[model samples]
Each structure stands twice: as structure tokens, then as C-alpha cells.
Target chain A: MALIKDQQLSCSHAATPEMRFTDWVSGGSDAGDAVLANGADDLPSLLAQAGKLSMIAIEFDTFADGRGFSMARMLRRQGYAGEIRAVGDVAMDRIDFMQRVGFNAFELRDDQDALQALQKIGEVSVHFQPSADGKGPAYMV
Target chain B: MYAYNEFDQTLIDQRVEQYRDQTRRYLAGEIPEEEFRVLRLMNGLYIQRLAPMLRVAIPYGLMKSDQLRMLAQISRTYDKGYGHFTTRQNMQFNWPTLESVPDILADLAKVQMHAIQTSGACIRNTTTDPFAGVSADEIEDTRPWCELIRQWSTLHPEFAYLPRKFKIAVSGSSSDRAASQVHDIGLHLYRNEVGDMGFEVLVGGGLGRTPVIGKTLRKFLEPQELLTYLDAVLRVYNLNGRRDNKYKARIKILVNALGVDAFGAMVEAEWQLIKGQELRLPEAEIERVKGFFKAPDYLSAMHASRDLNDTFAEHPQFAAWYKQNTRDHKQAGYRIIIVALKNQLQAPGDVNHQQMDGIAALADEFSFSELRSTHDQNLVLADVAQRDLFALWLKLQDLGLARANVGTLTDMINCPGLDFCSLANAETLILSRQVNETFDDMDYLYDLGEIQLKISGCINACGHHHVGHIGILGVEKGGKQVYQFTLGGSASNDASLGKTLGRSIEQDQVVVVIGQILDVYVEQRQTDETFLQVIRRVGFAPFKERVYGTHQRSAA
Candidate 1:
């Protein structure tokens, strides 16, 4: 499956092994390489493993529910430098906003063209807000 | 009044094109309806009951005359020759087709307007007092701060897809004309004892099935920390607000769930990390924006005030209109004329294309080529000279815009209910007409002074009925529309939610009940007591007794 990383469409890149947040935090489960968390998951539990985890995949179950964007932003602010991958219903319209709020890697849906979705990240270059992308807002600039 | 710079212009221009593409994709079957609904909503296009309603933002309710002309032109070209001004101080074309919305937006872009964030689940238009800069008893001018918020929240990446819609309002006046208390974030701009400007921020207030008055989140916030603090609050809401139920998903529910103190603490912690850093508004930028809102130059002609008084004696209708529709401006020679959209006209807030063009022309000639739309669904021609008021009133009378009912009983805030909106349970425009017809006597209306009657077709409270002194909410029961009345609410500085009266009146009995309620107020009131003061003085008992205390009362 294709994954968009650093604004480039990597056609043959395979996803890292990951586990659900419940499985990772469950009493007797293996230390998965990556943890899959939804918007409702508490960050304190995930921040403890922020150092050891190779990646944390935040499920974008619905674009309308914006908890994923907040989780991604909070993940960056809490010093999680690992790959933050977006999965589930990741459409082109939300891709640019996802990147601005700190989604670096995306697992594009099968029907979406990886290249076209990659081009969506910079659709509107002018920025009004300084978000998790580390770019300054134009007004402040 | 802040003119769009290159960045602002470029962003809006690109946004128009982007919306055009989205429309193209949606119409061409490249995007599904489920996905297109969200996109169209974010662009302020609602696939409503009758047709697509296009709500265009007035950017804190301030519009240039040319922009009003553009709206008139669009109404004539695309809509059904009229537009409805909403309580958010925005205008909505009720009959635009889905395909024509992009072209309408393109037309709006030529005049520095867009519908972005007007109806989305994101931050809607930041509204302030309609008499913002020109009012007599205002704190500081709130337009500059509103412009700052307007720009900062435009396409804000983090806030674009909130759990539900977020509304922010600011009031810098002693009287809260903006209805700041019922907003998600109500910024009460104030000056401290040390003479520095700060904000008293209120959070979590909203009106729907569940109504709440916002609680104070921060007692004092610095000017520079405005955007940052707002960011912290939004981030907190976006992260922790409920997603399980649609009805319980507003930020108000989250604030009440986790107490206001807890919400404030979390916001403080998040705000401390980014408060003075990223979104800190620069002093130069604030000053630059403030420069745009400087009061217009007053004409230096020193005409004797006695001449206008003599002219008023000659025309009693003009005198009544001058007294009712005009307000004292901060400038000595200037006055603020409220063009009432609540005549026995078509509907409460609907202005025809010809009236829109006429008002635009009047604004260009009398006022300073500027107009302000009030949240109560009226337009303001703010900078008219006091001497020109009689002439202006005559012209307004010709256009049927001078209803001479500024704050009287007929000046009601009514929602376009079941006829247009699928969310409504009953019709409101016709009810509004009935009320106007029942209270047609101007002298009697003048006697019943300053009554805020707000009505909504459903519990969504689009008409802001919760805060009205006399609020009416419609509901469907036994397949019939019945409207319940709430009493003693105020959306002013002293904000309070009204208490619901005893029983729901049938559709035809609303006007009669209103008449009986006003009669009770008149009977019990002191010499100078208004309807609300009488309600507060005697409590809701009298109004209840007048309506549902006994069947011996008037029958519906």
C-alpha cells in the first residue's frame, strides 16, 4: 500500500507493525512496535511510551469528528517525535489540514491516488494559524 | 473596516476557487453526497428543505455599500430577489441552487466577502455590537479585535472540524448588544484599573435543546494573549468534547461535564505553553487594524439645533420616526439610523433586492458608504448627519424600510422556520406577520416600549429565543404546531435565560396570547415600567395567570 511521507508519494512503502491502544495497555500483551489509538484515548497512557514507540497511528475514523486532529497536535506538543500516521477515511480535502496539525505520514485509502493526495497538502500555501506544523502564522510573521 | 491586505485577499480569492473546484467535483459525481455535505457546509452552503441556503458572512456584521449592492445583484441574478439577514449578523440567500453557489461566491469575492465559516462545525463569523464604533456608551471599539479574530479563525486548521459548530462574540459596550453571554466564547473587552485593555472571557454558553448562559472562564486576559487563549480553549474542546451523541456534542456540554474551573485550568495550562509565543498579536498589527476603525470625519457645518426642532414640529411622522428609529451617535452632529426590516413586510428579516439596492444607495449618500447589520435582523446606516435625518426618513418611507419600529413590540427576532429549514417544527415568518398585524398601531406600540420578542421554530434557538425578554419556541405535538412562551429573559449586559410559561398556545392563538400578556403588563406596570421590568417586578405569575392560570381566561 502507498503511504505519503514528507509530501512524497512512496508507492511501495509498507506500514510498520502496530497494535491497538487497548491491546498495548491491556494487562498481558506484547510490547508492540506501534500503538493504534482513536480520538477518545487518554494521552497520559500513550505519553509514557512516547519514547519507546516507533510510531503511533491515530485512527481518523471520521473526518467530521475532529478529535484526531487535536490528538495529533497534543502528541507533537508532548514531545512525541515518532512517526504520526493517519489512517481510515483519509480523503484529499482533509490531508492538508491533517499535515498542518502534525500528521506526517498518511495511509491513503485504496481509492485515493497517492500522488494527487500528496499534492493536496499544500493546496493553500498562505497560513493564518501557527499549528503543529512548526510554520509561523502569516499575521504574526 | 479593516481593508484586506494581499494575504487576506489572496486567501479569500484562493478560497473562492477552491470552493468552485469542490462544487465541480461534487456535481460531476467525483465526490459523494456524504463527503460533499461537509465540504459545502464549511463553505456556508446548506442543502436545506426548499433549496440551498447560502449564508454569506458580513465579517462582524460590517459591510461596505458596494458589498450590499453586490448582494442585491446576486439576489436578483441567482436567488428569488430577496435575502434573509440572520441573527448572527449574516445574510442568507434562501433560494440559491447548489451549482450557482460557487458563482455567487465568486461574485462576493470581487467585493471582499466570502461565506467561509458562516455555517460550518468550525468557528463561525465573530460577531460584535451592530453599533460598535458609533455608539455613545461603548468601551473601546471592538471592530479591530473582531477583525483580528475573524482573520485568525479563517480556515484555522485545528478548528475547522470541531465536534459541533463554535460561535464567538465580543462586546466592548456597556450594553451587550452582541449577545455575548450565549456564545461558546464571549470576549467582554474591558480596560483594567491601570488603563490597559484586557478581555473577560466567558466560555461554554449555547442555546439548543439545552440552553446555558456562558460562565466566566478568565477574569482578565491580556490583549496579546487573545488568539493564544482562544486556541487553548478550542484545542481543549476539540480533544475532549463528546462525540458519542450529536445533541450533546457542543463545547457547552463538555464545559458543564468537566466543571468550568476544571476547564479553565486545562486551558490555562495549554495557554501557558503557547500564550506569548506563536499567536501573540503584535502591537503594530493591532494599531494598524485600529487605524481602520477610526470614527468617520463629522461634517463641520454648525447648523443651529433649533432649526431641526422646528422642522420636527412640521412633520409628526418624521418626528416619530426620528425619535424611534434614530439613536444618539458619539459624534455630536451625526446619528445612527436603524433601517427596520420588521415592517408588516414579507417577513421579519427578508429584504427584497430593490430595498437592498435602495438602502445601499441611501448608505452611500447619507451614511459614509457603510452599513452594519444588527443581530436582531436590522440594518444600520450609521453616519447620517442629524440634519439629513428627515430627508433620509422620507426616502426610507418611500422604500418601505422606515417601519418606525426600532425596539417596539413589533420589532421581533423571528427565524425562517418550517417553510425553508428542514430542522424546524413550525412556520415562523407567517407568525411574525400575524404579530405585526395585531400590533399595527404605532402609538400603542410606542406605549409598549422596548420589548424583545424572539421566536424559533424549534429548540435549535436560531432566533435566540432563550435570551429574549419574551421568547417563543415552537414544537409539534399531536401533529399540530404549538408555540410555548418564555418570559423575563435578557440578552443584554445583564443576561439571563427566560423561564417558560405554563402551557403551549396553538398556532392561531399566539397573537392573542401576546396581546393578553402585554395587557397584563400594561395593567400591572408602573408609569415608566417597560414590559420586561413589569415581568421582573411582578414575576411570571401574572403572565401565566393571563394565559394558563384558568380556562376562564381567553380561549385559544
Candidate 2:
């Protein structure tokens, strides 16, 4: 239930409250509900609604399931600059990589310590490749 | 060897700490075992049947003397004083404790090595020809590109969690020693008509339950476009590859389903968007990485000596070892010696700490303080002067490494099957020993010429049995070990999967079956024709008839 933004504890602010991925995709009556996308949701259709959404949260069904990372990256590449939050099975070890792939806000699993996870976000000082962070690859740097 | 810069070192150190935290959390019951499994596997720790197995990555099979010594030290300190070399050009320590794996990775980090992506459903250690730079047949040195890909794939954020484990191999030689055809992404470096270096990008080739040869996605990808193209290929696989069924998750299955042309088009569409992005390899970075793999300063006057020939003349055993175990190097008077780890007495690719230390010393004295691990589960001293061949052979002989069967049938690539691996359905080491004993004569093996005999305890094909000239797969039926044999497969320039000869046979009959097959080859062979060439010429019918006899074929 904790939200972390830019490696610090943050409060959730959104135009539309949490909506299930299925309800968001079913063309529901609620037009302004900030949607939650499943890891397996179709990206192009999701991106089509990017302009209307205030925020979009992606669910990692399992921590080992990495389809969400690619989904987040695809969302970012498609020019969705809204708050992209990651929820479910989120742990401290995966924060740095998740951040690199464009997950700005993390709704970690209930067990993870929000403060401890913050320290882990910047623990890895260098990354070998360029990512959503827009920092050049370490080699170019 | 490619020396790690400060950035590379920092990343590894951070990774070690991260894994340490994960371990502590998992041990503290904060992280569940199922979630922690992938985390540990990404760091190259696998909980095995007997103990925790740690796979240490050796990028492109290159290692320095100090690094090899560090591995020996780790084996002595952490495991049972030995390590196993794998067909993917990595090392495995089979006796590590689950609690101590993070500490082992820290130790590896001190020597600029890490097990990053050595296993798991991620891009693995990028392997290349062991004789990469020193091979006379090489069009270009491939280690630099392997290093680039290694860095690109290391902790890659988006592609980390794929449907299945992915493997990539590179080769710059006309001869396909790296087995490029059987990898998820195979990069074959070559010069175009105008002398521009590029790669023929092969996609979706792999060995497993559904083995398929990689198809060429791009006929030639420019050198600068390698990473971007690779990124596109991986992205396509990650998003579109099947995740519903674990068995059908590998890119090979997707490539077959989508068809190579459609897959290539998808990758092309993706690449067209990211082609000139930051992932492009800058000229300076390419040159900087290439600098690490430059040729060593070989003595100008080094040449084959008359005294060495005289010594060889006196010692017939040394002569046999030199002729069979050594390969011609590009540099004059230099030879690449394959330190055979497949001696009949020792387990395939298992080297004791003592042997490791001795090999390190040998590398320092004879091979410019550098060594390589071949995909054949053997080590190589790639820059030995021809005049030092006698001395090197004698030293290797002292260590029981001079098997003189480098390319022979006895030098088989085998997996640590049911003996160590939890996934293996049957035993591999026993069958390996039986086959070794049945074909122990070096003279006969030499006459038989080059043959690749590979065995796997399961269909996962870690031993690459699918691509072996004589492939043997172990299966458990009715609580008994049964083996299936195939013939005519290869991992060379003309890579092909072997066809099954017939029905599975009992374990006790494996040796006799192989013997019968070789007998057929010997009976029908022309002069200088190898076992593979003979099989290709006569087809599998002749060998199958002899091995199974006429009655067994109709036994429905």
C-alpha cells in the first residue's frame, strides 16, 4: 500500500482512482478512471488511452514474471509521460531495474519496507546500458 | 582478456550486495521461496539434487591466470575442491551451500568475474570460438563483439524476464566452431564485398525439447547496428513469445510458429525505430573493447625446433599427444593446445583445485598468462610456441591431461546428469565411462578421426546432444534407464540435428550399440572419411540395420 516516487516515499495523487485492468479495458461508463494494466494487456490499445489517463499502474502477477517490465518500457516509448506505477510482488532487489524500465512509482507488496526499498533504488551506482532514465550508457558517459 | 573498467566492477559489486540482501530476506522468511528462485538463478545459483550449484560466467571463454587461480581458490574454499566446465563455456561448482552463494559471488567479484546471467530465463554468457583471435581461419576477432553483447545483456532491464532462457553465440571464422546455428541469436561476423565488417544475424536456434536450427533473420547486419537489432529481436520475443506454456516458451518455437520471415519482419519494424538510437555501437567504444583482445607479443624468432622434433622422435607418446591435441595457430610457430579434460579416469570437464592451479601455472609459463574454455568442455592454451610443445605435453601428461583424443570419439561432451542435476531423469556419467572404455585405444580413435559424441540425461539438452555427431539421450522408462541414439548431427559449418536410429535401448546395451555403429563405419569407410562423412554418405539405414539387426526393425 506504500507508494515510492523517485526513490522516496510519496502519496498517491490521481484524477481517477484504482480500476481493475479488465474493467478499464471493457469500455466502462467511468471515463476518467486512472487504469491498472495487467502484465499481459495489449500495449497499443492501452497507449491509445494514454492521453485521457492521469496515471496508469501495471501489475506484476508474480515477481519472477517480467512481462511488466517490457510493458512499462513500451508504454514509455509510446510517449506516455504519466505516472507509471508498479504493483504486486515488488521487492527491494528489483527496484533499480524497475526504475530503469520507466516505473516511476512503485506500490510494493505489503511485506517490503518502503524506506529500505528507497536505499536500494540507488544502490547500484552505474548501469551499463541506456534506459528510460535518459542517462547515457556508462560507456558513453 | 577483457579487463573490467571501474564501471563494470561497480556494477558487479552492487549486484553482489543486492543478491546478499535478497538472500538475507529469503532466509529471514520475508521473501517466499518461489519468488527467490528466479532471483538466485539470475545470479547463477541453482539448488541441485546434492547441493547448491554455482555457475561462474567466463565471457567468451577467456580468462587470465589470476582469475583462473581465483576460481581454483573458490573451489577449494567453498565447494569440494573441484569445478565442472560446461558446454556453454562456463564453470559450475556443485557443492556450494545455499547460504554461502552470495559470499562466493563477492569473492568472484574481487577477481573481476561474476555469474551474472550465467543461467535463468535471461540472455546468457555470450560464447565465441575458443581460438577466436589466434585462429588462422578467423575473418575477425569476435571477442570484442561478445564483450559488447555481454555488457548490453548484463542486467538488461526490459528483457530480463523472458518466456524462457536465451542463448547467444558468436563466431568470426569460416568454420563454425562456436556452434552458432544452435543458439537463440547467432552472430556470424564476416566482411562484405566492399570489405565492411557485418554479421549474419541468426534467430531462434536452440537445443531442447523442440530443437530447431536458427534461421538467418538478416543476411548481414552492419557492425554498428548489432545491439539495436539484437534489442529488437529480444523485444519481439519478450512481448509476443508464448508464456502460457513453459515448454513452448523458447524463441525457437515462436520462430517456427510465426515463420522466420514474419519474425524477421517484426524485428525489422522494431529495429527501424531504434536503429540510430543510443544503443548503437560508437566507433571508439568498439575499438576500445577490441584493444583488450589484441595479439600477445610473441617472440619474432620463435619457430619449430629440430631438438623438439628429435625429442618427439624419441618419445612416441609425446608425438602422439602433440599430433592429436594441438592445433595450428595464426601466429608463426605458435600452437593452440587443447588440454583434454575428458581423460577416461576423470569426469568430463571436472578439474580438481590442484589441476586448476597447475593449469594456471602452465598458462603463465607457456600461453601468455591467458586461457580459454572450449565448448567441448576442455581448456585451451591458445598461444604456445611450437618449440615448447614437448615440454607442455610432458607437463600436461604429469597432470593426466594429455589424453591425445581432442577430436576423437572418446572426447565426449557430457552433462552432470542425475548424478548432480535435479532435472536429469537418468545417469550420464556411467554411460560416458562405458563408452570411453569401449573406445579407449587412442590409435583407433585417431584413425576414426573427428567425431562428436554428446550425451544428455534429459531432453533439456544441456549437453547439446541434439547437435552431436553421435547423440545419446537418457530416458527413464518403467523405472529403468533407457537410451536413444541418433547419428549424422553436427555443430560445425554444416549444422544438422541427428535422426533417431530406432527405439530406445537398455543402459547395458549402450556400449554394444555404439560399438556396432562404429563397426559399420569402419567396415564401409573410404580412406580419410570421418564417422560423420561416412554417415552422410551411406545414410543412417546402414548403421541402423547393423545396430538393430533385421528382426528388431519390424518389432512394432
Candidate 3:
């Protein structure tokens, strides 16, 4: 398994138990607790708790299931300042795009390579379109 | 064609290596079959019945002569010595090995081409009117906008895996040759009263088991807001489009279920947040993209050629070919020549290596060194001089490409079918040949003017059968191939889906039934009325009764 943060290899954070959005909301857990949301989670409800959560790790059931990217963009737009990580199915080739859509951390599948994923981010220096990263397109740059 | 700068080149090159590594892992069994299938499909590689098929994108169907030659060379060296042009304005090689696909992509990258996003559940190649820049009816050249969308959608992270395959088309001409109404998102470029170009956006149109014409989402959108609005629409679809059932997963179903008004509201709301963000295209970049599509040079003094008309007067064969296979160009001295690939016995779009080479040479000599692949499985020399039409026709005849079947009954839009496609339910090549032979006479075909006969092996509608004037869908019934007929469909400005006839018939009866239907049209038509107009005027009752009524039933 590989962990990449801010386009580089990073040390793992201290372990925190992941709780569902329903459990975190109904159970009256601490506001700053870590929470996990799948692609199917309600985005408005998640955004309601974005400021309180320390980290929101959106899980991808399958790599091809791209609803998570939308969810991540919504969270970022809704003022989620804490770490927003992508969990599961994080292949190396998908890392750059994941980063573009406001994924600060990626927890790749067990078989993926971290160094390769880190290097992949630098392969393309400029992209034609802008994303949640707020970096303008290459032409504007 | 847009030249690839270093950024574009590097990204494509990186994608080649990335796919290469993925192919290596998949072949090594490190990646499972199910997992690698999506990856390969995103790169336009499909596992077909006979061998692996690779669909290379010809962006908006524009290609230089060298690029055409490169495609012919690839077909010669990698697979069989032929490539099939597709109804989506792309090319497919049906006999390549899975192991060699990356090497093929590497070669394509050398020529600024790749197969990325040609297939799979993603935004596909953005097609446009083949006569984008050269048509007399054009309001704005749509190819530059298509190229913009192409760059934005290629390898887009948020849309790589949508509910199902997505198609976008742009039509700049009033004629609607790109079939924009039958795409996932259709953009019609036009000038408002003030003469500033904008787009009429349509969403949720598609052809499949459930064929539908797209609905207008926005009456008019400014040119600079294309990508932002598209992003908003895609974001809405990504989050809400059905993923449980692949059959009902296209954006059309979602749009239908939600209602167009509600869908438009959602996209409008989403657009409010990202409207003026970084995705808004700058004026400079728009001009930069537009600069790539500047008009080619033409001779100033060569208006309507008297010599050409004289030659046409002397030779009726040349006159017939000219009338059927040529279109009016925007430029005074230029003409767009349709190079028909549907020769008598050949597959609809199958071009052998020699034909490809011949096409390249002809393009270099007469058509500004550029050629276009049309949505109807034909090639276009978009910038031919009117005076050179005779020479061009002669050269095309030598290559066996002067079939004079553009928009005729024999110029059918057909899929590769079960002969090559693993997804097909029945074979279609023999049926194509049978139908062509039955309607072979040029005089007879010209009399039956402007018939769009499309055939698909299944309901996937890769052949676009649903929009064909006489649509034929081949299905497997009780382990036997059956062909069903449909009527009154058209993919033009008046876009409508074909309604199914009574029932399917055996494969052998397909040609006979078509003949009977044509017989009815011949017997009960006003002078110079098209088959579609006659059907619209009289309805399908007369034709259906003739086919399914007592007289034809007894023969069956």
C-alpha cells in the first residue's frame, strides 16, 4: 500500500477510527472526529459537518466509480479545509486527476507503488483545464 | 488540425507509457481481467470476436495526408492490411493483438493521435459537422470548440467513468450534418441577432435500445462559457446518473426520469458556483485555438469552371458522379468531394492499405493535403478545386472509390457486427452485400433519391440504426438471426426516431422484405418525393399492410 500527500511521499498519520456519517451525526460524537463517506453519501449533509471534521476520507467502491470526485469537489467548494483523502482503488495513473479534484491525500490499493505514484504527478507540467486546485489553465498561466 | 505543443505532446506520451505499464501488468496477471478491461477500453482497445480491436480517434474527423498515410502504415504493419472507418468518424483495426496495442499507441502519438476516450463509459470523441469550415451555411467553425472540448474531456478525472458511454457532437451549419440531436450533449453553434457566436445546448439525446432526441438545456450560451457549462452538466450526471443497471445508465434515462426542466435547473444551479472560475475560457486561448482552423489558400481567379461544366456536358457518367458525390463549398472555386468507401462488394467503410495510400496521394494533389472522415462512413476531400473535380474523379475511379452512392440506398451506415464485434448478436457483412447487390443500379438508386439505410447487429446502435430512414436491427431469436425493420427515422434538422414495423423476419427474407417495401413506395409516390416524405405523407399503414398483409404473408 502507498500513501501520497501534496504530490510527495508522506508519513502516515496516527490511526483514527473511521465512523460513518450517520453514526457521526446521530451518535453525537466529537465534532473533530474522522469520518468516512462512500460515493452514495448525501453531499449536503456532509457539507454541513465539513467544518467540524478533522478529516473526511471519501471512499471509492471501484476505481471506475467517479462519484467520489464530484463529492470531493463539493466538499472543497463548501469550505472543507481539513484533509480530504481518497481511499481505495487509488491507482498511480489516477493520482494526478484525483489531486486536481481537491484530493490532498490518497490511500492507494495494496498493490500500487508509492514512488511511481509520486513521480506520476510531475510527468505532466500543465493541464488544459482547471479543477478544484484553483490553478488556472496553462494558457492563463 | 491543431498542432500539439510540448504540453499536449508530453501528456499523450505519458499516457502511452502509462497504458504500456498497465498492459504489461495485465498480461503478467498482476491485474485482473475485470479491472484491466475498463483501463483498456478507456484507451479504445476492445476484445472482439476474432481479435482485439483498436479505435483511434480522428478528432472532429480532420486528418492531414501524412496522418492518413501513418494510419495506413500502422494497419499494414500491425494488423491486417485494412482499417474500417466507423460511423463515429473514427477508424478501427479489428485484428490487432492486445499485447501490441501500446506499441500501436506509441506510433499514433508520434503523429499527434491516440485512441483515448474513443470508447468506454466516458466522454468520447467530440464529433462535429464534416463541413465545419467549408460549408456555405456555416455560422461559425465548430471544430475549434470541438478541439477545446476534446482537450478538457480527455483524461478528465471527474468523468473517466460515467454511468455509460457519452457522446458529444457540434454542428455549426444550419444543415445539421453532424446529427447533433442524437448525442449525449449536442451543441449547435450559431450567431444571434447581434452577430456574436454562441451555442444552443442540448442534453440527454442518444440512440440505443431507448433512442431519444436531445432536449434543449440552454437557449443560448456565450462561447466562452462552454467548458464551465459542460462541467456543470457532467457533474450533475456523475452524481445522479444510474449506476445499478448498465442498460439504463446513459444520461438520457437520467434526464428523462428527472424531467428536462429539473435537469436544467440542476445544471444551472451548479453553474452558478463555477461560472466565472478558472475554467472560463480566456479570449486569447479562444483565438489561439481558432488560429489553427484558418481557411486554406485557394486560387483567386478560378470561380465556376466552364471547362468542368463542358466536360460534364460531354460525359454523363462524370455528370452523375458530380451531382451525387459533390457538395457546395463556402469558397467560390472550391468543392467538397465525398470519396465513397462503399464499393459494390466491400464492407461499408473498409479501406484497404492501397486505397488509404491512394486517398493520401489524392488529398496531397487536389484537396489541400487534408481529408475528412464523415459520420456516414465516407471520406471527404474538403478543399478540392472545381476545375480539378474531373481529375479527382478519374483518380478516385482508378482506386475503385467512385461509387456515386453518397446518401443513396447503397450508402448504408453499418457496424462491424458479429463478424468482428463480440457485442454483436448477428452477422451483418453478408446482409450488407445482399442489400447493395439488390439495389446496385445507379439509375435506379438515383431515382430513389436520398435514402439512409442503416443496420446494426444489436440494440447498441453503434451503426446508428435508430436514426436511419430505413433502420434494420439484427437480433438473435431462438438461436436464429432475425432482422427487424423500422421506418420514418431521420437524423437531420428534423431528427426523429424510427418506429418498429410489425415483427422481425428471417435473415434470408430481409432483402425480399426491403424490396417489397420499396415496391410499395414506387407504386404510391408523387414525382420526386423521397421515401421518407412518402412515408410521412401516407404513414406506415400502407407499407406495413403490404409487407404483413395477406399477399406478402402468403409469399413468406
DockQ of the candidate models in sequence: 0.71, 0.69, 0.63
lDDT of each: 0.87, 0.88, 0.88
lDDT of 3 at B358: 98
Q: Model 3: per-residue lDDT, tens digit, A1-141? A: 567877777786734347887788888857778888887887778877788888888888888888988888888877778888888777776777788878998888888778867876745556766667776457755
As for candidate 2, its clashing pairs are: none
Query: In DockQ, how does model 2 score against the reference complex?
Result: 0.69
lDDT tens per residue, model 3, B1-556: 6889988898899889888988998888877788799989999999988789999999999999988998999999999999999988999998889989999999999999999999989999999898889988888899899999999998887788788999999999889999999999999999988888899999999998899999999999998999999999999999999999999999999999999999999999999988987688989999999999998877774563536777878978889998999998888877889999898868999999999999999999998899999999999999888878888888999999998878899999999898998889988887899998788888988888899999999999888888998999989999999988999899999999999987897899899988988888988899888999988899989888988898666888
Candidate 3 residues lying further than 4 Å off, grouped into runs, are A8-11, A123-125, A132-136, B551-556
At residue A46, candidate 2 shows an lDDT of 78
TM-score for candidate 1, please give it: 0.96
What TM-score does prediction 2 earn? 0.97
lDDT of 2 by residue, B118-140 (tens): 88889999999999999889899
Off by over 4 Å in 2: A15-33, B301-307, B550-556
| Candidate 1 lDDT, B1-556, residue by residue in tens | 7788778788888888888878887788877789889999999998889788999999999999999999999999998899999999999999999989888988998999999988878999999999999899988889999998998899988888898999999999888998899999999999989998899999998888899999999989998889989999998898888878989989999999999999999999889888788688888878888999987767864751225777778988888888899897888778889999988867888899999999999999898899999999999998888778888888998999888889987889999999999899988887898998888999999988899999999999998898888999999999999999999889888789999997789999999999999999889989999888888889987777778866754464
Which is the winner by TM-score between candidate 1 and candidate 3? 3
Q: Residue A139 error for model 3, in Å?
A: 1.7
Q: Name the better of 1 and 3 by lDDT.
A: 3
**Fnat for the candidates in order:** 0.68, 0.69, 0.55
